[model samples]
Target: MSFEIIGKTEQIELMASGKAIHDLSRLEKQYGQGKWRKLKGVALVRLRNGKIRKAELHWYEAHGIGKKEIKRKRYLD
Candidate 1:
């Protein structure tokens, strides 16, 4: 499943606990990993000065635990 963030980016908090890595591992265990691909929509990230920037979603994957592990990369536009 994909997540869409609403509201200001400042309101969003990134949890440490390796959540992102774990999630990607789980996804790879479920589905096979493949070449990096581009997503449809752009993500809005807020800077410290309250500036919003658009970024492209790039998804890549690697083999892990006999399955594919996925990693998401965001490229600023």
Candidate 2:
């Protein structure tokens, strides 16, 4: 990500899971597979320029694989 997640995420919701995730195959090949899910949430982030902001984040996660490919979707404030 271009920014660092400063704290815990909030309002987390599942956008997709399992076969519903279009990138499921790539996620498995890159990170190993186990009930992979595409999730979204809002969190405080520090941008590369050292500015802090609340942003919506999206990523892929699995039981043992942890979170991968985290991206900042948009700024909340």
Candidate 3:
């Protein structure tokens, strides 16, 4: 039961919702309150036509979610 999400705008929107969903009461009892980070990265992409392009990567990281950290990355390039 797993799937992948693609797109920068969609990923950022999801981050907003995830941030709002997390609070003191919902924080994992075993861990401290968590924080989030968005890292901008780059990658190489090959198109259908066999051309290589530089891609912009949008990666979001969050911790303390039920004892596990979640990371989501999006491509915008």
Residue 42, model 2: Cα distance from true site in angstroms: 0.3
Ten contiguous residues minimizing lDDT sum, candidate 1: 9-18
Q: How good is model 1 by TM-score?
A: 0.26
Flag clash pairs in model 1. Answer: none
Q: Work out the TM-score per prediction.
A: 0.26, 0.96, 0.31
**Residue range 1-77, candidate 1, lDDT tens digits:** 13333353332222222334545555545665533222233456455566556654333343342312212246456
Model 3 Cα lDDT, one tens digit per residue, 1-77? 02222332221233333455454334435445556443444455555566555554444445643323333233344
Cα lDDT, model 2, residue 54: 97
> Model 2: per-residue lDDT, tens digit, 1-77?
57899989999999999999999899889888699999999999998899999999999999977999999998988
Q: On lDDT, who's better, 1 or 3?
A: 3
Worst 10-residue lDDT window for candidate 3 reads 1-10
Clashing pairs in 2: none
Once fitted onto the true fold, the runs of candidate 1 whose alpha carbons sit more than 4 angstroms away are 1-26, 30-40, 59-77
The alpha-carbon RMSD values of the candidates against the true structure, listed in the order shown, are 11.8, 0.7, 8.6
Using lDDT as the measure, name the better of candidate 1 and candidate 2. Answer: 2
- Candidate 2 scores a C-alpha RMSD against the true structure in Å of 0.7
Query: What's the candidate order when arranged by decreasing lDDT?
Result: 2, 3, 1
